[model samples]
Target: MVDAHRTFVIVGGGLAGAKAAETLRAEGFSGRVILLGDERDHPYERPPLSKGYLSGKEDRDSVFVHETAWYAGADIELHLGQPVTSLDREARAVQLGDGTVVHYDKLLLATGAEPRRLHVPGTDLAGVHHLRRLAHADRLRNVLAALGRDNGHLVIAGAGWIGLEVAAAARGYGAEVTVMEPEPTPLHQVVGPELGQIFTDLHSDHGVRFHFGVRLTEIIGQDGLVLAVRTDDGEEHPAHDVLAAIGAAPRTALAETSGLAMAPRADGGGIAVDASLRTSDPHIFAAGDVANVDHPLLGARLRVEHWANALNSGPAAARAMLGQEVSYDRVPYFFSDQYDLGLEYSGWAPPGSYDQVVIRGDAGKREFIAFWLKDRRVLAGMNVNVWDVTETVQGLIRSGRQIDPDALADPSVPLETLS
Candidate 1:
């Protein structure tokens, strides 16, 4: 058992940061653990922010991973709303926003990520929001609350995870919503065009209008608040608010400024992390949306911004920091509930590796699953309106076996024996 000689300092109090701190105690690290967060709220589940929290089905307390008693009993120092301004690697210390310095033996960076900013005209105007932090969610929730009744409007830019979940929640509250994406199909980048089309149809069935193949040029405002959005197609949309969810870029400026051997990307993208989730410096580790960990099956590095990745992988990094020789070899899994549809997805396919995909069940019936395959091996799979088959398909992907479409598509074939 550790006897308080070593101090484990974790930066950023998001899902990853919280999980990492918990994993240390669970893994038998009894030394001092300090968790610092920029936001005052405890590390809560963010996926719900775009859904239940925004929909008013849940409140702020629902956001926390555990109650207040859990942290106090665990002997963890909880520092809320305290952000690290700089890292002095040479001194093994971190400088806080209020000029307080924190010394540490090992530093785990779960710094998470920030949404890409939209600097177009009227961006500074109120009602133009980016759904990233909990404070932003609270603001949107206030908007919905002030309406006094159901039905408002949400004009969302980018069809990524956050935008869809927000739209789904708003629609649940009887809000008229529209989503605009630059791609013909929003999920095309992840699941390919075929399955993405299925999502388009799913949203359309629920009266959610989609403006495809378009980009937001400007957000028009009235009285310093968003009134509408103008698109590249020379069309203007009158909207109550605008949400920009294009994507997130890693906040690696502090690490980079410290001369921590950061990698360069042509487009200024995600932070690079090895299999152990260690940055260029072995002493400094990273996890969550900010770090680009390698996908074992894909044989390529990827940044999975899903809650599952953060929850599981963060602890794995913490374990490594505690002298445990472990590697992060988990598949990417994420889910979203839109209208009556419960969509689950996993295991991104290798680039251009699949010639065709075999889908099982019907789409409109909302009870179907599709498999992305290459060389008969299940690269990735998604289940829509089907929960029973989740365990079956997930087992197939876990086994990494050869599968026959005829057998899988039949629904009679037990997914367990597909090997």
Candidate 2:
């Protein structure tokens, strides 16, 4: 039973914060639960912001984690548009932007990350945007629709998941698209060259131009609106709009101010936490993108900014908050929907960590399951357009057993049999 006198406060209004509040209630905690968020809107999922929402296929209300009534029903004090400015661990209180102070018996920092801004010249122009929130996606949708009607060009400054997804969406809206990447191949660092080439081919077949091994130096604008992007190769890509999808940095100001231990800069620079998601102070916990957890599977600390991490880590942090000794050991999982490709990846292995990649299906057709192996043991697996095999793939990695490469590559061989 929870101590009703104790107050549980969650800082953040994202998916992880909402999930943590829900978990506390589900675990029979009747304590005072408060969720504070900086945004005016309620907690919401962000994946569709670049794909379905930007293309106008999904409605705004669909992104929310819960209906507004649910918060009151669960006795959760929903504090929206109130940014927490400082965390006073000694006082056990959090100060809001409006000077409101709330004391908590236990605190969960689910503060998610923010997009890394592009500092190139003219990036502050009107036609340039970054997709991290609903408002950004809505504005981009309008720009895409206008470009679609006028046959305008949309220049994207990164070829990562967000950039590629936005490119696909812009193309669907009839906007001519160009994607620029600093690397030789997009997603090469994550999925390797061979698989990354497949995506390049996919985008190329759809008429999206790519400038590989080039850096975006400036955003050229006319009348304070983005007109083009100039790259290091001295090539100019015409643009009606520009999107910087480079990456994100953790929102760690609150944690830092609270004097919490932080991870190393190379390890994604987040609040350092143990396997139980507890920070230095036993009463305070951290989760989601802001948390650099000592991952059991990786045998090192990792801070994952994907949707799956937020979804799984929230409840685990809540369990730890409720005096339960629980470890957030779920393997990292992420998926992307770009044009015809529905990709699902499970587990984690840094680039160059795996020795061999064995495929079970046709790569040319984009219908395949590829396994990344180290010492003949599965380290990670990705299913491209393959159905209902995620659990099986994750099972293989969890089992940590060596298997014949021939069996891994054979389509008729059941993955369950490999164990």
Candidate 3:
């Protein structure tokens, strides 16, 4: 019942790759499906790595996308712990690290992204960590536990989501936490200053120290173990561990070397693809964090590194691979849990994109919905401690309707009536 002639090869066995393979089978494609991954573990989600898993609230088994046996049962050829060395675009094949060549009729690149490393010295030293992988989380979880027990200090770089979440987790473990950020406010580029102060207040109220407008200059260590970190401002803070949570850069080495088209660095660089997720080569396609897609709804080329993008784009790419008309236009979405404050943000409204930010409900009590509007059109929305309104928020973004700021801000007026 299998068609050996039509083989679909998926590179990078993360959630996107796994979901793409699953989608292929679910869509009745009974051909040869091969998945390759660099890590030994099965495909898993990355969000838990910084949230529940890092905090010791979730077990290791909870991270995997599917059971080990599911791959074989679904007739998916899975190669774990082996990374693809190079892509032969002309030959329609990929070379493995061990010099093995695997030919494919269609190729899907779900290579994902890697954590941006700090350029400062002492990064290679012991107790300096980055939280991008499961292994990294495992190590950081234990380090946090130990630091908590010893009443040690954690020096985190960057005030992004990962940095803020880790700061909260470190505090929960009873470890002293301090965050260093080059930006004036936390998540300045994402939510802008209007709401960045909310997160700053949230973390500060939990006793987390913040050093803004400074970059890490050096990391001082004793016996190769981090002792403290020095900032560009010439301030040295005692640190038992250092976490670089700056950001992630899309893994595009293979795509670049293979001569596939790439998006410009100014446009959030990644492998460039159209709405169908098709690359420069028709035989090859891309999805997830690695693919910079020309979004139909947003009318712009965008690269999203959030969990939702990976969750949805994988299947969309698979459908496209199967020769289906695919238009990936899902509104970008991401959620964060920092202490008692939990928020879900939908749509895209980076700095300079929106003209106004309207808030509904109480900001003092930490319960509010903030909407970013451009030309009176809802561009994005963030609901803090608000429940069951994701559909409405996303609907407003999708509709692209000009909404009254007063009605949008009033809790008395139902959001559904705005549309």
Candidate with maximal TM-score: 3
- What TM-score, over all chains together, does every model reach? 0.94, 0.98, 0.99
Off by over 4 Å in 3: none
In candidate 2, list every pair of residues with a backbone clash: none
- Candidate 3: clashing pairs of residues: none
Per-residue C-alpha lDDT of model 2 across residues 1-419, encoded as one tens digit per residue: 34569899999999999999999999989889999999998999999898788888999988999999999999999999999999999999999999999999999999999999988899889998899987888899999999999999998888898999999899899999999998888887778875788889989988899999998899998889888889988988788888889988999999997789999988879999999999999889999999999988778889998999999899899999999989777888999988889999998877888999998899999999988999999989999999898899988988889999999999999988996
- Lowest lDDT 10-residue stretch of candidate 1: 261-270
Better of 1 and 3 by TM-score: 3
lDDT of each: 0.81, 0.91, 0.95
Candidates 1 and 3 compared by lDDT, better number: 3
Per-residue C-alpha lDDT of model 1 across residues 1-419, encoded as one tens digit per residue: 34578899999899998999999999888899999998988888888788778888887889888787888788889999888999999888999999999998888888887889887888888888888888899888777554325456779898877778777777766677899999988676777787778778877888789999999999998899777899999999978878888987787777777777554564234667778888777778888877777556557777777899889988998998987887787878888877777888877764386877888888658688888987888878888888866666667777877777788787787666785
Off by over 4 Å in 1: 1-4, 145-151, 263-268, 350-353
